[model samples]
Target: MAAILVPSLLEVLVLICLVSTCVSSKPTNKIKSLNVIKELNRKGKYIGLITVTATEENAFFATGAFMPHSKHPFVDLAGRRFFVGKVNAAATTQQLLDHFDLKGIIHFGIAGNVNNSMSIGDVTIPKQFADTGLWDWLNPNATWDPSSYVAELDFDNYNEPNFNGSNNLLGHLGYETVQFFSESGDPNTPQPLLWAQVSEDWLQVAATNLEGIELEQCVNSSLCLPEKPKLVVGLSGSTANMFVDNAAYRDFLYKNFNVSSADMESSAVVMTSLSNGLPVIVIRGLSDLAGRQSGVNAYATFGSLAARNTAKAVVQFINNIYSFSSS
Candidate 1:
C-alpha cells in the first residue's frame, strides 16, 4: 500500500510541473531577467544615467562630483547612487532596462540644434520627444496624387536656391511620423500615440530649479560663441537613426516639428522609459547648427564642449532629483 501511494504522488508532481511549463510558454510582453538578478531592494533606489557615446560619458564624470563603485558599474555622489549606461544606439538603451532595476532615467548627450536662435554649448531639456525617421519616398515624375501618402513634405515647397536648388535632388523625398501603441493598454482596443512626453512633475522641478544654472559659452579663448549659452527648457526634440547634415531637411524639421534639438537616440530611450512607467528626462547640448551653418558641420569642433555643458547641467539636475523623489 505504501509503495502504491509513492508512485501516485510522483505522477501528480510530474503533471503539475508540465502544466506550469505549458502555461508559462505564452508571451508575457515583459523583460525577463537574463541572469540570476541580485536583489537591490534593500539598498536605496538608484537612478539610471544613460549616454550615447564614450565622449559623453567621459564628460559627464568629469564633473568630479561622482565616485565610482569599486566593484559595480554604479557611481555615488551626495549619498545618491546611479547606474551608468554609456552604450551607443537605441537598442542598448532597451537592454539597460533589461539588466538593471532603475527608479528613473536621465539621458544626456550632444545634439544638433535646429533652432537657429540657440548657440553651441547651450543645453536643452525638451518637454517631449518624437521619432522623425519614418518616411515614404514618392516618384518624382509621377502625377501629383494627393492620396499617394499622408502628411507629405513636398520638397518642391522648399526648393529655394539655398535648399533643393535647381538640381531638385530631394523632390521625391517625403517625411512622416511614426505611430506607437502602448503595451499596457487594452489589447482588444488599442490607441496609437505619437509623442512620448517626459515626466511633468520632474520637468516642473527642473524648470523651477535649473533656470539659474549658467551654461558654458566657450570651448576656449578663440573658439568662444558670439552669444552666451543659455538653458532652454520646455522645448520639443526630434530623434532618428541617421545623422542630420542637410540644411534643407534641418529647416523642414524645424518648420514641421518645432524641435529645438535633434539626436540619434533620445526618442527611443524616452519611449522605453515611458513604456516602463519610469520618469525620464533628456539633456542635450547643441553641438552644431544641424547644417544651418555656412560651411562644414560644427559637430567635430564643438562636440566636446557641448557634451561638457550637458554634463554640467546633468550633475546639478541629479542633485535636485532627490528632493523631487522624496516628495
Candidate 2:
C-alpha cells in the first residue's frame, strides 16, 4: 500500500511540473515583454520619438489630441505625430533597446527655470546639467549635500564665442526668442524675464551617449513651411524632489549649479538614455522661474507654452533625423 501511494504522488508531482513549464513557456508571456520591440521592428529602421507628460494637463496639451498609441498602450499626441510613453530609467532603457531597435530618441517636454537669465517661453538646449538636487549622499567623500548636482558647460567660462556658436545657427533661423512672463507688471514692479538658448555640443554629446549614434545635419526648418527638421540639443538636470514654488530652494540651485532650467523629468531621461546607449535629446522651455516673487500664476500660464515649444522642437528634431536617415 505504501509503494502504491508513493508512485501516485510521484505522478501528481510530474504533472504539476509539466503544467508549470507549459504556462511559463507560452507565447503570451514572451509577447508581453517584447511587445514594443515587435511593433517597432515591424516598422523597420525608423526614428523613434518619445514624449513624456508628467501631468495629465501637460500630457493633453503636448499631444494636441488625446489618444493612445495602438501598439504601445500610450497616449498619442499631436495627430499621432509622436507616441506618448512612460518608463522608469531602467525599463525605458530596456524597452527602447528591445523593441524599437531605434536609431535615436528625442525627449521633448517642459521644464522650470532656475536661472534668472532665462525667461518664460524661451527654449533651452543645455550643454550640461548638474544633478544638484540630491545625488551626493551616495558618495562618502562628497562635499556638497546629496540633494543636487550642477551641469557644467563643455566650453570654457570665458569662451563666450564657443558657448554662443549654435545660437547664431538657431537664432538666424528664428528658433531663439525670449518669452515674457506677463505684460501686467506695474510700473514699480521689477518684472522677471526668463530666456533659453540652445546648447549645441551638449546635444551632440547627449545624442551620442544615449543612442550610440551620431547626428547629421538635415534641411533647415526655416526653409520649409512644414518646417524642415534640424537636430537640436541641450543639457538638462534631474531632481528627486518636486520643485515647490520656493524662493530659498531656487536660490540654492542658482548659487550652486548655475542651472538655467528646472524640471521633474529630464534627469531620468538623460540617465536612462546614457545607460542604454540610446540617442536622447531634450528641448525644454522655461515655464516658471524658481523664486517666491516670480509670481503665483506662472506655472499655470507658462507651463502650456513650454509644452508647446518642446513639442515643436521635438517634431522638428525627429523630422530632421528622418531626413538624414533617408538621404
Candidate 3:
C-alpha cells in the first residue's frame, strides 16, 4: 500500500489563493528606501512591464483599454505590455508596483493652467514638479513674503539661521532629494536644486513624434472652445492640495517656478517615481485657467477635450516606445 502523505501549510495556502484571486500583501523592501524597487511577484516570471498611470476616468481612456481594469484582463498592445490601473496619487503609487517589473512610468491628465499665454486645451510636458504647500516656519506670527515662495530662493535669504530643511517633515526616502520648498520662512533656499526632473531621453523621443499633433477644439456636440488648441513642451508644474483658481496665485506660481500647470497629483507622482530611480514623464492638458479667468469653471466645459488631447499625445508616445528598456 502507498504511504499516506499530508500537504504542507504553505502548499494548502497556495491552493486556496489560486481558487480566489485575492491580492496578497506586497513583499517587503530590503533597503526601505523610496528608490528601492518593490518585490515584483512571488510567483510567475517577472515580466518587465511598462505602464502608463492616469488619475481620472478621462485620462484612463488614454491607456487604450476598452474596459476597466476590473472587468478586462491585462492585454499587450503596441508590441509592449499595456495595462490600465486605477488612478495613482503621490500617496498610493509607491505601494501599487509590487505586481509588475517596472521599466518606466508615464502619467497623463488635465490641469489648471498657470501660464496665461496658454489657452484651455493646450497640452504641456512639465519640466519639473515642486511642492508649494510646505511652510518653513510653524509660528503663526511669522509672515510670508510674496517672493518667498520662489523655488530658487537662496539659502542666505532665510530669516531663521537655525532652520533645518524639511527632512523630519518627510522621512524615509532611500535617495537624497534636490528640491526645496523654503528654509525657515526664508526665501533664500538653494538655487538649481531640482524637485522632479522628467527623463530627457523620453522628451527627446517625444519632442520629435509629438510635434504637430492636432488638439481637439471642441469637447462634444453641445460645447466648443473659443480657439483651436495648441501644444507646448518643457514647462514647470506646481502642486498643493489647495485648488489654485485666482489670478494672483497663478501669477505667483508662474513667477516663482515658471510653472505652467498646477494640479493636486502630478508633483506627488513625480517625486515617488524619481525617488525610486524610475523614469517618469508628465503630460498635462489645460481644462481650466485654474481660476485665473473669470466665469464658470471651464473644467466642466473643456475637460473632455483636454483629456482627449493629452491622451492623443500619450498614445503617440506609447505607439513608438521601441527604445524603452522593457520594450
What lDDT is reached at residue 127 by model 2? 57
What is the lDDT for 18 in model 2?
Answer: 13
Q: CA shift at 273, candidate 3, in angstroms?
A: 1.0
lDDT score of residue 69 within candidate 1: 28
TM-score-best of 2 and 3: 3
Q: Estimate the TM-score of every prediction.
A: 0.75, 0.51, 0.62
- Model 2 clash count equals 30
**In candidate 3, what are the lDDT values of residues 121-201, reduced to their tens digit?**
999887778776653432333334534333433223323556564323321111123453333324655443436677787
> In candidate 3, which residue pairs clash?
34-174, 35-276, 153-189, 154-188, 154-189, 155-188, 158-186, 245-290, 245-291
Judged by lDDT, which candidate is best?
1
Q: What stretches of model 3 exceed 4 Å from their correct place?
A: 1-55, 62-95, 137-194, 323-327
Estimate the TM-score for candidate 2: 0.51
Expressed as tens digits, the lDDT of each residue in 129-219 for candidate 1 is 8788767777777766655443467767756667524545566655554555456765555444457799898788789889768887788
lDDT pick, better of 1 and 2: 1
Q: Write one digit per residue (lDDT tens) for candidate 2, span 247-281.
A: 76666556655566677655554555544554555
At residue 230, what lDDT does model 2 achieve? 28
Residue 206, model 1: lDDT of: 83
